[model samples]
Target: MKKYKLILFSTLSLLITPVYANDNAEQLFNERCAACHSINDNSHITLRERLQEKAPTLYYAGNKFNRAWLQTWLAAPSKIRPGGYSFFNNVNVTDEGDVIDESKITTHIAVNSTLAALLTDYLMAQTPKSDLIALEKVTLGKINRSLGSKDFNKFKGCGSCHQDEEGYGGVSGPQLYESIQRLQPEFIASYTRNPEAWDPKTLMPNRHLNDNSIKKLLNYLNVISQ
Candidate 1:
């Protein structure tokens, strides 16, 4: 399986032409990723649903992804859904009631390091206009008693249908004790804006929060960074 994976990655690298060979990551991003993501848009939609029927934007890539992780994810594209990505927007379903189409789900084979590095660098360069909030700079002391409770019950409403820091919320979406460390912020933001953007058939709802909620959530995730 390891050899098979290597062969697959090699085949993909070969497919990336010499014209694109040694192509600057930014240039490659412009040519390949710009169509689906915005560099600075901060609109925050719902968990499963996207503002538009597209995937999320990338305004905060710099703040979100681990360069190493980014490289690994992009070298190969995987099916993130059981029946592919879709939303329950039209269904008026609750997050608790929502269901993922597992039949359409699949994972991508890992990629070679060089291609991954190029993609990671390209993605990491994207930054939002906001000043460095350094939300990640917050100390472990801050996440103690009161603040931790606030994270569970306050404006975040994370407890409503998902688990995180306190593990007190509903079990709807993925856990987030280290979500910031796990997901690309840009990817998360973009998905927040438009769940259906990349996969038109996802089961998540489209959140329609104003800009403030978006920033707050972003900050919340940064604070929760592992």
Candidate 2:
């Protein structure tokens, strides 16, 4: 009888531990992250609110980021966008051109390894736009580096905002060289197709790229990321 009671207790503990951990993670996120990063669905966000947002919305983080990359990034956060999340707040008009005021750019809050893992696990479950991600069909194909570079820099003009290489291109947007590692492939394709659908007030313009163009861009991104 005692042995059976012990076995039941062990089984009950195993079932309850996951729920407890998940609850703890949720509480931690609410305390440590809710002030800056929003975990709620922000589809109805106004332009004024978006302009005032301190960080990117994480409601679709599961669909947007690679799990490994998100986990690693949380442990030791680095500057992805050189001009910060709201670029207008950090730009300084200079004689040469509009330069990013590095002083205004603040570092992301880093978490310890244990907390990072817990937060990442919780954040990675917030996939509200799984349907949107599903609609994107990403296929890796070869693209000529010279032609791709020409299209990205001159014709498409992505270089005006994003960097394809370190210390090169514009600084207003996140660096694209590491995007393949940082973002999910489906997210990359979907965002490229329609940035406004994902981020209502994003500075990225709607290029209305066709399927072939988007695929070519994805190929280019993969190449550069490698």
Candidate 3:
């Protein structure tokens, strides 16, 4: 009889453990991440609003980021945006135009291992309902480097905000030349399909390119990353 009672107690404890952990994660995210990021959509916003914002929205972060990457980034935060979130306040345009003064880039907040894991768990659960990314089903396409370069620079005007080469492109966005190293190919495809899906208040405009174009862009990213 005592053995049965012990078994029941152990089972109950096991069941309760994950619930408690999930609760802790939610509470921690609310306290830490919510302060800087909005878990809601704010993507279709103006430049003034973007300039005033403190952090990027996490409304679709689960769809946007891989769990492993998020965990690693949380523990050892690195620079993503060249000019920082509030670019108007942090970056200054020179005689040469918007050059990134490294000193003005805002540092990311770092978390300890435990907090990082908890935060990552909570963030990974924030999946947006979208069919844009069929991760396992989608295959990468080949890039014509020359044409891709033209699209990235002139046709799409992505160069106005993002960087492609060492000394080129704009300073308002994270450097794209290293995107293949930093992000999953599927993530790149999904983000290109709809930037608003992951970041509602993103300054990036959705160009509505076909899947082939997105795949080519991703291929170009891979080539550049190497």
Candidate 3 runs further than 4 Å off:
1-22, 43-50, 101-103, 134-137, 141-151, 196-201
Candidates ranked by TM-score, best first?
Answer: 2, 3, 1
Best by TM-score: 2
lDDT of 1 by residue, 118-191 (tens): 76776677656234332223322223545554745575565555555543444445555555666656555655
lDDT by candidate, in order shown: 0.54, 0.87, 0.75
Structural similarity to truth (TM-score) of each candidate: 0.50, 0.87, 0.75
How many collisions per candidate? 35, 0, 4
The alpha-carbon deviation from the true structure for residue 173 of candidate 3, after best TM-score superposition, in angstroms, is 2.2
Q: Which of 1 and 3 is ahead in TM-score?
A: 3
The collision pairs in model 3 are: 42-200, 42-201, 43-200, 43-201
Sort all candidates by lDDT, best to worst. 2, 3, 1
Give each prediction's root-mean-square deviation over alpha carbons. 9.1, 9.4, 9.9
| Candidate 2: tens digits of C-alpha lDDT, residues 1-226 | 9999999999977754443354698887876788998999787888899899988899889999999999999999988987888888898868977688889988888887888889889988998889899999897776888899888999999999998988788887899989989999999999989998788878899999999999989899988888
Model 3 lDDT per residue over 1-226, tens place? 9999999999977754443364687666765668788877676777677667788777767766767878989999986777777776777778979766677666787987877888888887776644555652446455778888898889878889888886678877777887765666777877778887766656688999986677677777877777
